[model samples]
Target: MSSYKSIPVTMIETDVSYHKPSQTFRESVTLEDSALEVMTDFTRVTAISINPCASLEQARERMVSSGVQMLFVTNQYHEVMGLITVNDLNGPKPMQAVSENGGKMEDLMVRDIMTPRLKLEALDYEDISHARVGDLLETFKRMGRQHALVVEKDTSTDKQIIRGVLSTTQLSKQLGYQVQSSHMAGNIAEMAQGG
Candidate 1:
């Protein structure tokens, strides 16, 4: 082994351009900033989920306990298969299932009443850059959705990932106002009448 000499280390400065300015941090943000700012990013909140085979009553209980209007129905591998919402429970799906099967609410499965994943629509996270809260509110109203999923292309994995969610209820609470959905009536006759 050879004897080694120790040298004093000098502090290395990072490139100033790489750092964000303090003013940028101090700037007051508004709902108009970007949809991303208003969105509940996955990094901050975990998606609430339920098993697809669970009973409608169980699903309702889970939703009540989770304090979410909807729950992602997952399979054995924990992959999203569909989604169940308070609307589905309070609507005709469960009743139709009960009528068809001649069984009680407990006999109705979440999968039977869930809105399949294929029917779900998502917005690109990049699109949020130019999107405003008002725009999102309008979209929710037009689409008759309480929540909207935001998908982002992960650079590292080179895959599209569900990155965030925007909720009308949450946004309304934050804004201190109610954002009503245009599809609230949700009657088939009204729907067929071009509502």
Candidate 2:
């Protein structure tokens, strides 16, 4: 979508392969050229984040302010924890309903009902480059999973740290199609070109 010259993926291996729902493929994929110098580098990151200590209302506010569907949860030390999505705030707790006949910001706390243990449940792309497009598409099949906290180990501290957040909405927008449709397209993109 730009008029400038593009980055070429002419330097990588030609045996790039991926599997899809209907079939599998092996192809050579070229990427637009950029300062990063590689397609893999282009996927570094670009997501908004929040702290787990904040109130649920505060987290929701941050997401709304940032205009991001997902909010990466972090701790006081700035280590990544888990995540919360817009969908997580939509429903009411039965206890809240019984107590006040409705839920209010005051009725909720970040830890009271948030999908707990997200700090330990985060997943990471240890081999991010190997995660094919088909795998990405399969992730979209899950419900209410727009934001995912990617975990990585901090060797220095021997602690698990949050490295990144993956928003399905952002993925869909970037690819210009439903996340579910990306499997085949991604698999195709991963294949080796005949030329």
Candidate 3:
């Protein structure tokens, strides 16, 4: 039998501060930079999410509090059912939903205006892994989307798992310029065409 000795303990310091997590993004990045530099990797940071049945107000509150423009609408099992963005909350979708469903604004749920999983699309992580920021930007412009999901196949389950997200707002922050939305581009094109 082996005997274990107790180690001596020291008193805790009152003025000591706890360590906080710090994630640093490059102050500036060119389009030639790696796409991974702009992606919000789920492996490093937890994704913000909300219940599908939650009120639209609740969804908005969560996004505001989290400093995110989008939130995944998850089921009880934590499976993503859809996603909601700030545009869906503040745009005409809410009013349209109310008018179509004959419900008051307060009665609207997150699912009422969220983009369903069926309509959503993702970029394979394998492709993103080798892509440049410019390639990602071109993809976003071609798709006419402000945000895109990145997925990787789970080897054991053979299921697609959302691994990260690419957001134009985040890209803009990293690039030191605003990435125009599709709507903005459309308006610019309209003016150019003298319509």
Tens digits of per-residue lDDT for model 1 on 1-195?
879988999876886344422211212234455666567677666788899888888988998976789888888787778788899999999889878878787778898899998998999888876887656766786787888888888889998778877777776665555556764334323422442
Tell me which of candidates 1 and 2 scores higher on TM-score: 1
Q: Which residue pairs collide in model 1, if any?
A: none
Clashing pairs in 3: none
Highest TM-score scorer: 3
Q: Could you give candidate 2's per-residue lDDT for residues 125-182 as a string of tens digits?
A: 5744456543544444443355455556778998865565555554544444544332
Which residues of candidate 2, in runs, are more than 4 Å off?
1-53, 79-82, 92-105, 118-120, 142-144, 180-195
lDDT at residue 92 of model 1 (Cα atoms): 92
Query: Which window of 10 residues has the lowest lDDT sum in candidate 1?
Result: 20-29
lDDT of each: 0.74, 0.50, 0.86
Better of 1 and 3 by lDDT: 3
In the range 22-46, model 3's lDDT, one tens digit per residue, is 4567777777789999998888788
Task: Give TM per candidate.
Answer: 0.72, 0.54, 0.83
Which of candidates 1 and 3 is the stronger one according to TM-score? 3
- What's model 1's lDDT at 74? 88
